[model samples]
Target: MKFFNKTGKLAIGSRLRMLTEKITEDAANIYKLYDIELQPKWFPVFYVLSQGEAKIVTDIAKEIGHSHPSVSKIVSEMAKQGLITEKKDKADGRRNMVTLSPKGKMIAEKIKDQYADVNAAIEQLTAQTENDLWKAIEEWEFLLEQKSLLTRVGEQRKNREGSYVQIIDYIPTHREAFKNLNEQWISQWFKMEEADYKALDNPQGYILDKGGYILVALYNNQPVGVCALIKMNDPVYDYELAKMAVSPTAQGKSIGWLLGNAIIEKARSLGAGKIYLESNTILKPAVNLYHKLGFQKVGGRPSPYERSNIQMELIIKSSPFQKTAE
Candidate 1:
């Protein structure tokens, strides 16, 4: 009957729901032993109202993370059992406010010790696990706060089904999308320094005006991927491959390859001598992609970025559309 051990790690949501049901069942048993009539399902709404304050059903639902309809049903049941009372709010006559009745308050006072004992039992269960469940739950909640579970799932789904992608040269309107995509990747991997900000925030000033090129990958007419080739100050290298990023949702669809080739071929068309790039070794996928494109590791120059741990240069042999002699 225990699902936690049987279903294994990937069934986390299932395991948590099962654990909640077991805890509710245990609390119900404790109430029975204490000679108190209470259902575990009614605990959240009742507890919120038991603080000597009247609250509307909408407020109760929000505080307890239940739907309005569910709380409404529970309030109706509590009223039928003579455990609570409902009346129109003084401030808003149309809205009903609920409060614990005298009988309900008496029951809560009688079972206060029993509730404490139930909570202590649950605390003891946490000691049985290698990691404290409360701490893990807190961390997980914080992470979900940063990026919701629904968003992460949706991004994964989009990554798998990227069918319509069009690689195009960057235009004036794509300024924001290019900046946002680059900022996301840069902030995740490393801090966005002054140089990065200057380059991204004003691409025309830092890139196109200096004879550099930018390529954008569009999915459904929205720019989801971007890469840039910036003309270098040094004579040896003509352009520095910089600010390449694909949207998390549009990734894993060879969009990187699409943007990379687009920019590289653009460099060849401009008759660039050599294309170089700088990146950190921690970005394994990006570094690997550069290697696959025939970019070779070279001696390091004094980099403006602290994240630079790898430098590469690409020697494009010839244009793809052009053939070589035997």
Candidate 2:
């Protein structure tokens, strides 16, 4: 009986380890085929060195989300392979600076070429299904992020309950709630014509179809705010955030901030490099929110709508608030 139990557990553990080993073996094969010497552990270190100066081992560990001891072991292995060298930091005796050696630079250059090749191979493999696959992945990732945020917010509220809210995806059921909120916003700020308001209301019609999204804020299960993203056709920028609205009752409670930030986070997660929004001077609070979120004024462009107004753009990739949103 004891032998049988031990055999059963060993079998299960062996199968799990075998699966993990297979994945590592496949990745190693790819690296070998591409003549790339850097393994998963070495890639980040090589990436940092390729960027500029030798980084402290602790900094490398932080950037790669690894323990210092783990990074040190990898670095030591890399040094043995003549891929990296460690030097003492002059100012800090405790820290060691890690730099790539000449052979490491050669391998890094080959890795860059292989990176493009691997992407091309993937593109070829998914040529027929890439669009749908990417869309599903994006939506799944977005929903996961929202769920994660809800959990974090819920935990925080338990400790110190505040005026926090989590808005989920916008679907047909929430259409009327979002429309009413937008109508109130237009009435107060833009004095937008019925047609203009109508166009904005059907965000799906205007822009939400092209990797765009609509999310509605809920308080006690009642929709009180809305935000939408529009993928830009610009060759330079990837997308823009637009159609942000919050009901007057929810105005001062930072609902707008939450909506704006959610849109930005979703955009960044979808690989958008920058995001811009149009607004008028009358909406000072909205503009202030944008500024607080690191948006800066850009040269005014003609509005698509005759209502025409001021435009502000945020370089999402460079914004300091990116990680917080993530």
Candidate 3:
């Protein structure tokens, strides 16, 4: 854990540079393997046009951060390939409007499929490594965004059941079950402070008020576990995981496991790339659970919690998940 040391600045930078090269190499390999003749820069240009609504060539160039000449050349080549068509703008005839041609649309669809395949291949190669990479990126981005940004706020565990788990959302009137789970955590580890206990009790007031979501597990019509999706306004990432708890009665039954997977799936569906959480080291089961669920530990940062906490994060993607019963 050299990166965790206060003097680990060099180690951290080296690690980041290595990751960048690896990702770049991976991208190049994917394009070669797929036999995609389209250059990396053209993907964004074609993607923008495929989204409908004719766009001015200049605007497309600006949006993708490419120079006018560069984009112009690429667009011209695409037109020759019958992938796109350019027309003079009616209001400003000097400006050219770009639209995807039939061939262009087909190419766009193929690009989308190739993108999904690349992601699947990466996931298969890295497994949880993807999660760790995202967590590091989010943490670094957060630090750069806020001068007072803190890291390593808590530790979490992985879901016991593999990747797929039954998830439940919109569990109104399940406050009592969650309260019971909080009590179980307090009794088994350390008593929950009054404030922390209160936060768990009022999910709507404490969590949802901050643009978060509450989910609970049910068995035979009984509440079994609970977790929340806490929205982060930080520019680094859009959401965080908070106030996760499971009843001691349901501990060995993988209730929390399902709850964790459900939250991860929900976050991914919402277009979130990273999820952060806070927990204590004393909660060994919880720590291990987060790891199993693809969460990784990072440097500690300041937070409202009084306990010695560890922070964990999971990277999410748009991979399909099985629909759960309502």
Candidate 4:
């Protein structure tokens, strides 16, 4: 406990394992007190069989949240102790069904009272605590299911490294990176169209020289992402957010978000009132990122690329507001 206090949350796995061992040891002692000749690990299987239905090892494992091999080992131990009987399944000859033997059934009947007592004791213990451990554990499990511990740690690592990432104006050096990043993503999802080559092949002539701007995200002084604000001649929209791409390795580091905000600022500085973007619905993450940057879905826009099926626009405001999304 003192070591855990010093190490904090980093030793959570070790602490949980230690706690489980203590509980398991106490459970074994409790079974002995009940005069039940059963291993603590085999109780779940025994209880399930007591309900009068034969089950296979796979079913038992699923019901008790254990692995197939673990349940198989416990079944073998119970069989060796003459506590369970196994027979070929009538429905499937290759499969074997398991059920409690006479000795196991007798022990199950004797443990009914013990089960009630243990349930009441557990309830009393939880009621005495300031916060119910059972409910707290359920909440923790739900949160972990939403975002796994590995994903959370990966995001933290990305955020730490993100400090070294810089958003800068596009230059000749980033031309190859810009083309390759966009091409990689496009070729993975959709075929590159003539419009893609026109812009990606010559970003300066097609976008930058035409009263537009491009922003590049550099992580460790290397280009990882690119976003372009192409000048539009439409009546409602002043600029189009186009050709946004990030390297697969550099994803989840907020590079796309950084480039998006920088390009929006540049559009505002150029006296732009609205920014538009065309994207496909299949690119869910990209569409979500656009929405986080204050872009709203719109209709009635013609696209040069066949892959574009959705259009969005953002209204530029005079004062900058803090973004809430990462």
The regions of model 3 sitting more than 4 angstroms off are 1-166, 320-326
**Clash pairs detected, candidate 2:** none
| Residue-level lDDT tens digits of model 4 in 1-326 | 79999999999999999999999999999989988898888888888999989999999999988899999999999999999999999999999999999998898899999999999999999888899889889999999999999999998998888888999999898899989999999999999999999999999999989999888999889899999999988888899999999999998788888889999989877779999999999999999999999999987577898999999999998754323221
TM-score of each: 0.52, 0.46, 0.45, 0.73
Off by over 4 Å in 2: 1-163, 193-198, 318-326
Compose the digit string of candidate 3's lDDT tens values, residues 192-245.
776576577687787777777889877655666788888887776678787677
Q: What tens digits encode model 2's per-residue C-alpha lDDT throughout 1-326?
A: 46546788546546657766986787688898877776865666678777768998788889977798888888899999998878888998887888888888787777777789777976886786636665775796788677875575566654442255777898878778767777777777556775456446676676666667888888767888888787778875677676678777765567777788788888877778788787877778888999988788888886765554778888866346656666
Candidate structures ordered by TM-score, highest first = 4, 1, 2, 3
The 10-residue segment with the lowest total lDDT in model 4:
317-326
Q: Which structure among the candidates has the greatest TM-score?
A: 4
Whole-model lDDT, model 3 = 0.74
Per-candidate RMSD, Å: 14.5, 18.9, 21.9, 5.0
With candidate 4 superimposed using the best TM-score fit, by how many Å does residue 103's alpha carbon deviate from the native? 0.4
Off by over 4 Å in 4: 56-58, 88-96, 116-128, 171-206, 235-237, 264-326
lDDT of each: 0.88, 0.75, 0.74, 0.92
Model 2 TM-score on a 0 to 1 scale = 0.46
As for lDDT, the candidate ahead, 1 or 4, is: 4
